[model samples]
Target: MKIEAHEVERRVETFKAAVQEAGLKLTHQRLEVFRELASSADHPDAHGIYDSVKHRLPTVSLDTVYRTLRTLSDLGLINMLGTAGESIRFDANTRKHHHFVCVNCGLVRDFENEELSALQVQEDLVGFGRVLETQIEVRGICNDCRNKS
Candidate 1:
């Protein structure tokens, strides 16, 4: 899907009230990192985030970006996506959606195949009755990238 900058700005705007509710300062670095996440389709990692915002904030460290990403992920404002042998990728779309990853180029794109989401999960824990989280990452070649080979 083609998500635009305005759409991203709107999403971050939704977080302003909640950010304060969490007693967070919502500093310049925080906002800048989030805004970049919102606008990106690259499925960035902490290093990628640092690269994007470094020009504006030269001293922003890689550790700062990682910490911010963890905060955002904990706040339910973003998603940390990764596969069995991949670097952690940050997703701004916190919604329950799947992704198709390109093994060759490491490109990530939103996957909308609803049938996969409908698959059943086996519940085997007899005593534990609480379920709080589920994350699925599907791997494959993207259409354009597949066609190029």
Candidate 2:
């Protein structure tokens, strides 16, 4: 799904402020890379991001995209999805939400659940450490994939 132009601008501005606060250069490449991700809801991996960024920036390298994504993730401007052993995907939506993952075709869609978002952590879990956040991943075959069967 495509985000609104205003929302995209807001995110880009946030990125700019974060980059400045983190003592990082706000280069053209970094701006383009973040714009590419911010405008997309596909939850693209580094390679997917590189593919789009390279079109607009012929001088951009795959390694640069990878490093930029890593930096953005480290700055909490974007989210890194996927479990261990799975390809890491990036999401620019930083709001409180969950994911509906298509196990068959690998589509990741955002969803919101008030109950889930408000769920309290168990005492046993809290005993281990402080809980920073919570999110649920609902896995199922997407309509397109199911229809193909």
**Whose TM-score is greatest here?**
2
Best by lDDT: 2
Estimated TM-score per prediction? 0.80, 0.89
Looking at candidate 1, the ten consecutive residues that score lowest on lDDT are 127-136
Number of residue pairs clashing in candidate 2, backbone atoms closer than 3 angstroms, sequence gap of 3 or more or interchain: 0
Q: Look at candidate 2 and tell me the lDDT of residue 149.
A: 98
By TM-score, how accurate is candidate 2? 0.89
* Regions of model 2 farther than 4 Å from truth: 123-128
Tens-place lDDT per residue, model 2, 64-148, is: 8999899889988889996667778999888889999888878888888999999877646746876788888999999999889
RMSD of each: 2.9, 1.9
lDDT for model 2 comes to 0.88
Go through the candidates in order and give each one's C-alpha lDDT: 0.79, 0.88
